[model samples]
Target chain A: NAGVTQTPKFHILKIGQSMTLQCTQDMNHNYMYWYRQDPGMGLKLIYYSVGAGITDKGEVPNGYNVSRSTTEDFPLRLELAAPSQTSVYFCASSDVDRGFPGYTFGSGTRLTVV
Target chain B: AQTVTQSQPEMSVQEAETVTLSCTYDTSESDYYLFWYKQPPSRQMILVIRQEAYKQQNATENRFSVNFQKAAKSFSLKISDSQLGDAAMYFCAYRSAFGPRDTGRRALTFGSGTRLQVQP
Candidate 1:
């Protein structure tokens, strides 16, 4: 079903570089989230959208931005990429109204900032 | 703020044996949910099991089960007949039942995680 798809599975960026991580879901879920996993740590929410046109910052939102213009797409933007931003990013979608049992996560985008 | 804690940073078990990964959470809300997510080398977060705070009965899925202690806010996962595929980093997560309308967001607070190693 292509639950959730994240583009650029792997990337390398130099300092001060900015890039966008694309995420899309065919499930048409209203709830979508972006999370980053640092080494030896659990995933931390970066940003989330309850639905298109409604977005909010999450626990770790610094240096990142997100937009939800359509139900199928939620993209994460990394500005001024720093070594600290070197980590794996995951996009997840869930739907309480659709009776989704739990979240369906994307494979993840592994980014390295050197 | 709600928080999840996984005391065991790492655990290992012999193949075919059983292993338990412990998780405890702190929350003031009575209605909430708990989840166990498995992340192998692939790093894809897979839900292992889930428990509702209001439900007294624990949740189970095949060889995986959770011991839900609502009073203690403790949710531990039990893996039976462990195999090589069972080896992964297990994470405990918490989410509130009510999604605040003001922000329109209900997010999961996850524990650091427990690395599970299955010995052959």
Candidate 2:
């Protein structure tokens, strides 16, 4: 169903290098989120958007940026990547009206910053 | 701020047996949502079950069920007749209630997660 798609399943970045992680969902859901899961740790929210043109910082947004210019796309940008940014990134979406607010997650992007 | 906790870092259950994973949360709001997500070795996160705060009746789906205690602020997942497919990292997550402020609450708070092993 192409529920949620994330580009570049794996990547390795050098210190100070910048990159962007792409995420798109075909569910036409209004809510989208970006999160990173560290080794042996649970996922932590980085940023989220309610709809096109609306976005907000999440728990761990300091080193990341995101924009929602369209309903189906929300991309996270990492400027001047640091070693601490190395983690598995996930994109998720949810349609609140679907009766349950549970989210559908993408396969995830395994990013490694050395 | 809402926080989710999964006390069991690892669990093992023989195939065909039952196992329960523990989860706890801290939240002041009365209305919220809890969820269980399973991440297989393939790294795809799948929703296992969900529970609504106002619903006194526990939420169950096939072999997956949740014990929801509102007063105690505890939510746990139980997997019955475990299968090899059940071996994965299970995460417990929580979200704030829906409303105009829903945008702010849209971000889910996740616990450290529990790795479930199914022994055949």
Candidate 3:
């Protein structure tokens, strides 16, 4: 199984630009999440999805949006990117039955907004 | 609300030695989960070990073990026979068992990571 996969391992965006960070999991997990990690800081959740058509904002969801149209895909949209948005983003998935078991993380997408 | 804290920002251990990373969390809920995740240079978060709140005995996996103190709200991870591959940033996370009752919105709160250096 490909477990979890994230696209565009690295990218650079200009202020006011927009882009989507793509994430997919073949494990058929019901839970998917988007988190950003700054240097020396713990990861902060931006958004999460329970299932298709369901999404919710997390602790640090500002300047970002998410949509889960299918069980395998949960994409994060950054509208009007800013320099503060530069960080390493990770896509994760897990089965709810396991009651929040350890997440399977993607290789992470490093974003730099100038 | 829950919060996790990792007191140590950086640590060093000689190769083949042992090291313990300290973690403490604040949570009112009695039932919860604690985890230690490793992020190597590759930036992949891997689960090192996990401890259930109710479990009295500390959780151990091979050379990785957790010293879970329920009352003290302390959870420390000990890595024995450390190797170069064990060098990475470790994060402690907490998840509350009680949520909106929908059960699908549960999320983890992570502490600032501790970077471990394995000296050869």
| True interface contacts reproduced, per candidate | 0.58, 0.86, 0.61
Instruction: Estimate, for each residue in B1-120, the C-alpha lDDT of model 3 and write its tens digit.
Output: 688999999999999999999999998889888999999999989998988898899999999999999999999999999999999999999987656455543677899999999999
Q: Write candidate 2's Cα lDDT for B1-120 as tens digits.
A: 999999999999999999999999999999888999999999999888988898999999999999998998899999999999999999999988868755688778999999999999
Q: For residues A1-114, could you state the per-residue lDDT of candidate 2 as single tens digits?
A: 869999999999999999999999998999999999999899999999999999999999998989999999999999999999999999999887435675889999999999
Off by over 4 Å in 2: A97-99
lDDT of each: 0.91, 0.92, 0.91
> Which DockQ-derived CAPRI band holds candidate 2?
high
| DockQ of all models, two decimals each | 0.60, 0.81, 0.62
Ranking by DockQ: 2, 3, 1
Q: Which stretches of candidate 3 lie over 4 Å from their true place?
A: A98-100
Tens digits of per-residue lDDT for model 1, B70-119: 88889999999999999999999998887445344367789999999999
On DockQ, the stronger of 2 and 3 is: 2
TM-score ranking, best first: 2, 3, 1
Per-prediction TM-score, please? Answer: 0.96, 0.97, 0.96
